[model samples]
Target: MPAVTVDSTLELPRVPVPPAEGTRQRPVLSVTTAPRGFEGEGFPVHRAFAGVAQRDLDPFIHMDQMGEVEYAPGEPKGTPWHPHRGFETVTYMIDGEFEHADSHGGGGRITDGATQWMTAGSGILHIETPPEHLVLSGGLFHGIQLWVNLPRANKWNPPRYQSIEGGQATLLSSPDGGALVRLIAGDVAGHRGPGSTFTPITMIHATLRPGAQLVLPWRADFNALVYSLSGRGSVGEQGRPMEASQLAVLGGGDALSVAASARPDERTPDFDVLILGGRPIREPVAHYGPFVMNTREELVQAFEDFQAGKMGAIPAGKMPHTAPGEQRPV
Candidate 1:
């Protein structure tokens, strides 16, 4: 929960309150709780986008809320070397540290509040793992990995990477000085974040003090969603209950709101949420284990190309160190 913060919200620039009369407050369409699961190398994760309709999540293929768990010494784990195509992977590290390396020469360390954005456009091979020291002396590890679907036209663009440091995010406050909004990508109220995106989208991590409300003017063309990261809260004017690991898909409107309950869950003192929206791609989607494409034929071709080594080769002497008893990928 210490992704980014300020000693006092009163010191930050304020997000102006939307006019009440002219703007429509988005209604909550549905609220779903993420089911727990284990991800790469047996790390815990919550499948945040589960049970949501594909149309509603268009331009966003999948997401996983990787552990709010505290790990003991020698227990940290990460993904094996894998190939991906036709999409982008955004890894935001909220607490612990993760190291990323790819076949296309894109690699970096993403730690506390930083983000590593990798566009696996066309095709690429990559690996994400806790650093050796973190592996030896385990600590809290929490983060999110979101898969952003690329439009058919841009799916084949050359691979690229961006390392956005924690302090790079645009920080703003609620007019009442009750919330802190960290803009990681896209524009909000004419203020832009650091990460550039192929798809038009906005990603914000906002924290609201107990009983505080955060309202933002939203783009009418983009679909909106709010996912609770910690504590208890409510979404929309109707006051749909929201808690940790719950996602609320909002109906069409000119603005959106989220409020923390006066009595938040004991786990956290404030309610934190991830608010995101993107212009719908509105194209057919064919997704598999690691590839997202517009058609089954393209997915098949992606696998063939990957197996044929067209994605790129592992760097010399830099093969990922496999865990004991873990099988190596072919």
Candidate 2:
């Protein structure tokens, strides 16, 4: 008998392997009620997991949701030039426009449904404010800003920036057509997102129709959380319900299940949820004002550098327009 070799055309029956025990456990969700904090003088913001004890939200140091309030003409205010070091800043605009300028000669405009990710590796001075048109005419302003910490090894890396338009994001819809997820980073439904990240992280802006459900897979090592932006929703296997402006911290698990509440009397029929997670950095965090570093000495150096004009100043003139093809630095 001749030796038989599996032909290239041979199709083998595939068997699914069960996930390891303990790894497949459904996550537990706990609601975290974050208080309001003012930024840039008057901008009201809700900080998720605020305070030192809650710093367990690693990789993700801070998360802020800016005003859903409508600004009257000439009342729109924004942060002036400030310095940051040793981390990254992510800004997502839901409505209105934000003009930004950074020390690396990086400047651009992010409008509704757009995003800006800036890495202040060593240090960078930047300004983010509403454009003149919006400042004068006034309009609704709503957005989110997240601070992602960098490992100590990469804290002094060169600064970089990236901007992503809403259209460029990977949008995935559920099979039942009741849930939609806009992936800014990481993966969803086998589709990757547009943003580049130093660490493994997932950011998904999800919307669920009334009474709809979504079961999303997540890495077991990642620390995950769900933030309710609007309406109401239940998360995790325990069905922990959360309302608007609340944060749901999740425990170790491989998957998360979320469902939007059925509200007949509510004007908004859908629920908005922001799901974020990242692998822990597990390092010391020494932060002061806009600077975040692993040591107090490094934090001091950042301030000294900014005062000594190390971080270049924004040019005194009209805001420069971003050229085509310009992308955020990786």
Candidate 3:
């Protein structure tokens, strides 16, 4: 859960408290638990956005909370070569290392609160895996992979990548110094994060001490959501109870609120959450498999292009394999 941390919240810039008058508090419209699942080379994941209406998640496509699991030596895993189009993949590593390389010449190793943001505009081929050493000696691996959809106009924009180091995140605190806010992207109280996006969105990882409350000013045009990453907490000022792996869809408002419970689980120690919102794309979404497009015809074209090697060839000598666990070092 340590995406990023500060020695003391009091030293961070404070997020001004939303004024009581004229500011409407965002209300929790619904809360749904993310169902457990597996992803990329058989690693565990929680389908965080499962069951939520796509309309409510406009401008955002899919998200997976990857492993809060501890892996034994030689047990860590990652995805083989894959293709994507018409969206961006934002991978934030909370506690472990992940190596990413794409056919378009974007690659890097991210770990311990760092982030790798990849835009699959038009199309591209890529792979995500644990570095060789991490695979040889498995350790804690936890992270988030969020799929942000591009609008129809920018669907075919050139692909891009951003490797935002953990320290590059904009750190802030709640008015009372009871919560730590790690702004990974977009603007919060005019404070900006490192990652850039085709679509306007805000991504934040926040941790609250037991019984602490955090209120943040939110853009009225953007749709809001609060996903609990660990421990117990409440969403909205009215205090709708939420627990680990739960996703809360919030209704329109000028601001949002989250509060940690007085008694949190011993395992997590604090209430951790991901606060996300984006300007609604509000277009006809025709998503299938790895392609997010505006029409079925476009999706078909995407597959055809990928099969024809139009996306980009894998770098010389790269081959699809399960993981280093299958080929241990001597």
Candidate 4:
């Protein structure tokens, strides 16, 4: 794998918002629980959302919350090389480190609070593995990976990569110092995230202090949902309380409010949440394992490309941390 860097002083463009003088009217539609499953070898995960049979979550096909579990020494595990096409992958680390390498000569590392956004346009093969040191020492490994679907027109665009450090994420706090919002993509409190996307979307990792309240604006047309990552919280006007690992699917509205429930004798009384959504693509989707295409023919073609060695290959045996660039199709 090779080191990928971004300009330290680069500025992300912000999404405009109207004045915030009036009351917000967002509503809670239903709540859903992400089923648990094993992925990438034996890594345990929670399937927060997916697009199966129908495009339930358009512009976004899948999301998985990697383990918050602790690994014992000599028990390391990770995903081996795999092929993908027609979408982008966003991996956000909450506590652990992950090294990634792709066939397009793109590679990087993302650790605690950092993010790796990879565009698997057309077709590409990649692998994600934990560092060997972690395997020996044993520690907590937690993170989230999202599959953002590209519009039909941009599905074949060239593959690209962006690596953002945890410090680079925009952090916005409430006026009363009760809540903190880490904007990874889209905008929050007029501050934009570093991620560049092909579709209109927003992703915010928020934490609210006990009994604290926060209001945030969102586009009316975007379908939205909030997942309680940790602690207990109430969402929308109904004050429906939810515990960690529960997801609240929200109805269309201009804005949303979230509050954490107070807990006595708790040292760190904070509720963590992941807020995500985007405008629906409303187009037909054909998916097969790692590949997602608008048609079955394209999906089959992706498999053919991989079998024909068009997606490139990872060198045999131990891979170097950095390697010479490989030629790829334009």
Candidate 5:
């Protein structure tokens, strides 16, 4: 995988990974895309729809922005079928709808500005596509897809879904400049979001008015990173602009500090930030395709089970309840 450039103007900032010699300040790693996602194109990848990795910034492995731009009808717009395991996949949309189905017995459609949280526990097979709603409108389709790893104890637990409608997400006013903040998983300042979580996690959405500097709190031991969806601000005395479709891999803070506010009487530019952080898994991360486990034996078991045509990703002997009439002949 080649390193995806965030911007030459933005300097790199890095904190030491665990078990290193000592506390150290390293240069920031540039953003990069996965090899397969390149569509066989050569290096120096283009930035049409790139997913930045917070893996180095925090502990996040992959963060892909699916729809920053709109799509027209019959324009070949959709994410072809794919697979996932070992980590939790989170899909959040702002403008257009996304269609999804999986070999794991979970399938549904999400309208624009909606979010779907899928935990690919054990071994699950899945795919995602754009909904027909956008086909009719021929308007824009945009959304975000993120991958979060599970702790060693819970990696093979079971796959589950938590869908949050655009209206269901909790929105609150910030302590300063009246910025709007939406909590998706954890609490911020005093505002709590409505999304369910299987791990100790914090995911929030924030919008800053021009010249407004808003600061958000985070844990020191836990890893956290901010994906700039839109707008500009100084990240703790360092002037960094969080523009639409770009990301700001942050550094320097026991508590994550960021500022996005309206300029003195100046019209506020659109600014959106996704602040995600959680307890880092100190264990080794063995990722192959989608299944994340501790060792190669576990990864091989996952593949063998998939080849045997196992329907769901949940562990054996534990089947979560499904809606009536959902059970069908195998």
Candidate 6:
């Protein structure tokens, strides 16, 4: 398959979710930042990572509540370059634009609403810089960069990628209102997320219409979280509304369900939510920076191998040296 690039006029899909049955429980919205040690623009993320869903939310590790940011020209930050290992870094662009190049001979640019799914198997070195059109010209640079862990068995397979641009993504309408829902991955309303997934996970992008009631199922066995991108709505049946920048938590059961209704008098426009959850991985997780391993011994060997040039050497001047794999010849 070929790489999918994004254009300025591309429109992202807006699919609406339907109201589910049952007197479900409400979700607990919590504010979380990255752990104390790591320091970067990506720290102190708005929600959970290695917290309540650490081992429970397998496949998915954490989501970096990325930008809806409007950066000034030459501001402190516009775009960024980073490295990764043992997982997949998926970027869902909503506004602005982003261009990236990696050691795997993969490079491309995608604008708002495109999904970039990159799997850093053994290791990978890459730089992601935002498009000057949006950054320099002063527009919104909005999106989410989610971290999905590779299962113990699939971790070292190979570094690869697949992406779905603004086109090809499905757009479904709310059964009643003008609201919409978009599927970045997994199946909803009979339309499976575009492209293929290495794991059985589902990610839905949804909006709430006034007084709209929506109830959805949760895999009791899988851990899940509903992230409020913009708007107000209470999760589950617990009874309380979660505003912007908060994440609501729901535990695993034989199955799970969420019920919510939009507040009519609320000034918020359509309440946007990025619903993410997945099956749990009960295996041991030895994580350090970008690499995640099953055993401490394996983790130790990985470090030694990286230092001795086993995976591969890092490019000339990158700090910390996270990548340890051969780059495809350009």
For residues 1-330, what per-residue lDDT tens digits would candidate 5 score against the true structure?
A: 001112221132211122323323221233232222321111111242245533543345566665445445654255433445677888787666666665556667776556788887765655555555555656655556667777778877777877887667666554443356666777665556677766667887766666655555555555656666655554443455444445545453455555664542232264566777776666677766656677899888766766565635432322222321232111
Ranking of all candidate structures by their lDDT, best first: 1, 3, 4, 2, 6, 5
Candidate 1 local lDDT, 223-245, one digit each (tens):
99999989999999988999899
Q: Model 2, range 123-157, lDDT digits (tens) per residue? A: 88777888999989998888889999999889988
Best model per lDDT: 1
Candidate 4 lDDT by residue in tens digits, 1-330: 001222321133322333566646578876777788888767888888732323446778888988777899866577767888999999988877888888877777889888889999988888788888988987888888899988899899998888988888877766566776778898665678888888888988877778977778887888778888777789987888877777787877788888899871253467888898798888788877998899999988987888788876766543443232442221
Clashing pairs in 3: none
List residue ranges in candidate 2 displaced over 4 A.
1-26, 51-55, 264-267, 318-330
The true-versus-predicted C-alpha distance at residue 213 of model 1, in Å, is 0.3
TM-scores for candidates 1 onward, in order? 0.97, 0.87, 0.96, 0.87, 0.72, 0.77
Error of 6 at 124 (Å): 1.5
TM-score of 1: 0.97
Backbone atom clashes (below 3 Å) for every candidate: 0, 3, 0, 0, 19, 21
Best by TM-score: 1
lDDT of 1: 0.91
- What are the runs in model 4 whose C-alpha is more than 4 Å off? 1-24, 50-56, 264-268, 315-330
Displacement of the residue 225 alpha carbon in candidate 6, Å: 1.4
**Candidate 4 least-lDDT 10 residues:** 1-10
lDDT of each: 0.91, 0.76, 0.90, 0.77, 0.56, 0.59
Q: Which residue pairs overlap in candidate 4's backbone?
A: none
The segments of candidate 1 whose C-alpha lies over 4 angstroms from its true place after superposition are 322-330
Q: Candidate 3: where are CA atoms >4 Å away?
A: 317-330
Q: Pick the winner on lDDT between candidates 4 and 6.
A: 4
